[model samples]
Target: MTAHEERPNEPILLRRDEGGIATLTLNRPQQFNSLSMAMLEALIGAIDDIARDESVRAVVIAGEGKAFCAGHDLKEMRSSHALAFHQQLFRLCGRFMMKLTEIPQPVIARVHSIATAAGCQLVSMCDLAVASENARFAVSGINVGLFCATPSVGLSRNVGRKEAFEMLVTGDFIDAREAQRRGLVNRVVPPDELDAEVERLCASILAKSPLAIRMGKQMFYKQLEMGLDAAYQLASETMACNMMCEDAGEGIDAFVAKRKPEFRGR
Candidate 1:
């Protein structure tokens, strides 16, 4: 059966598309939008759908209610003590995180408030993040005697090892501006301006050639794990291939003619 068919009540995830941008809002406000099994499945389904949709140029992940996301549903996690169940749950969460990077469209985290534990990891996994001034972040699993092992992967990639480790070990919260300075998020704006800032980023990305964005995003992430020489080799090949596209030709011609280039996502 379809994922939605299994849900007999209110949806845990809400999705809306507008002007080439798809906004996926985590919908468990009363629970602080924690990542339950149902929520993860819903997100995975929505992301798979977005990946196949050419009309979507960008994606925004947002949370409803006061906090952005407080991480996994602790109550649910405690309900099951089986080692196999915990393993499967984490594996599913990891898969959902990796899917963010694999998708062609740029994923932006719209952090309006606190994003703790795995929720903080979710922000780190996003391609870009715009957080409100009031937003706070922490990998707080350590506070309760559980290390955020899975979250450390994405957190370490985004910030310095020392900073990520410090947060992981101490479970201390950092303000939005500090998170930006440490590279956890790209921009921090007033809470009232959070949506506007996110839209600004989406607009900038949407204005670019879709083909180039897709090609570059894939190459960008892959090259990060390669040696300098191999990275350069891959980047050169990507640029060469991008240049061969019709949008590149049109863009060059338009530049020469001093006019706006019309890109058809070629």
Candidate 2:
């Protein structure tokens, strides 16, 4: 049973926070946690809220049920059947994907099962991904006669052009280890150890200075779009500004004093 069929009235997005880590679970387990229009809206609202909250140092995007996400809700798409509607849907989803990288806090995808179509796009867009051994990924929209054009944007950015094209055209699903090898995911662990691995990754990010991380993340994405000299110029300015932050001074001094630097997030 799909998430919509199994639990039609449940919340689409669920949020939980502890120890500076914010987890946003796609809660339509029966429907394979697919991204319907409502689901997209829910995610956008949750992400916007998280962006304004300083307490959220990191975010984990996980899905509940047999699959991480099955991509767009096909049944919903069939019901629309309008060119304008299709365009708007893709546009909204594209904005959501861009926002994932634009956010200050790092976003990590917690992939537990099959991530197909836009589901795979979600994994590619995250700053980092940790998949369970049981996880599988593919942008398989081509199988149904519609090319995964939007998903290709993130997939190509994460992996190689030829490889991304192969998946797009063939609709082949790659296992978690292959996803890792292709640079789509950071690590792949046993299914039973997924939470532990996510926690480990989350803990490492939390240990960094928040201001530095916030600044660094902005520079990281923006610099990728610049030329070598321009990238270095921007990086140099970013570093100079970062050096003047209170946390930078404390971090350098603590290193010399042989003590842990306390960051007040200034």
Candidate 3:
């Protein structure tokens, strides 16, 4: 049974925090955690809250139940045959995907099962992704006669243009290992090891200086959109500013003195 079928009153999105990681679980299990309008709104709100929270050093987006996510709620879309509604829905989804990159903390996708169409787009938009060996990915909207235009935006950015276009047109699923090889995910482990792997990735990010992570994340995405010379100029300026931070100085001193650095997040 889907999460909604089991508990109709439960929140469609659930947030839990432990250590420095904030995990957002998509809660529509019966619907395969499809991105309905309400789900999109809840995610945007949670992401906005996390963006301002200095304590949240990292985020993991996961889905509850059988699938990570199955893309848009087709039932909901069919419920409203209005063009304006469809336009609004895609616009909201695009905004949420963009926010994942804009946030200071790194967002990692925890894909336990299938992630298709907009669901695949979610994985692509995240800073990193760790999937189970049993996981599958696809942008399969073409199967239903609709092109996954918005999903293609993130898909193209993550993988080669030809590879992404092939998926768009074929509506074929790629296994976890293949997805990793194609640059869609960072790691693929056994199903039983999924949680452990995600936590391990999170631990690595949490060990870094928070200020450096924040600054580096912002600079990272910004530089990706710039020309080579402009990108270097921005990177140089960022490095100079980062070097002036107290954490940077302490890190260098500790490295030379053979001691661990205690970063105050300045």
Off by over 4 Å in 3: 1-8
What's the TM for model 3? Answer: 0.97
Each model's lDDT: 0.94, 0.92, 0.95
TM-scores for all predictions: 0.97, 0.96, 0.97
Flag regions of model 2 displaced more than 4 Å.
Answer: 1-8
Worst lDDT 10-window in candidate 1: 1-10
Q: Tens digits of per-residue lDDT for model 3 on 1-266?
A: 12233356898888999998999999998899999988898899999999999999999999999999999999999999899999999999999999999999999999999999999999999999999999999999999999999999999999999999999999999999999999999999999999999999999998889999999999999999999999999999999999999999999999999998899899
Q: Per-candidate RMSD vs. true structure?
A: 1.7, 2.5, 2.3
Residue 13 local lDDT, model 3: 88
Candidates sorted by TM-score, descending order? 1, 3, 2
Evaluated at residue 55, the lDDT of candidate 2 is 97
lDDT of 1 at 149: 97
As a whole number from 0 to 100, the lDDT of residue 125 in candidate 3 is 99
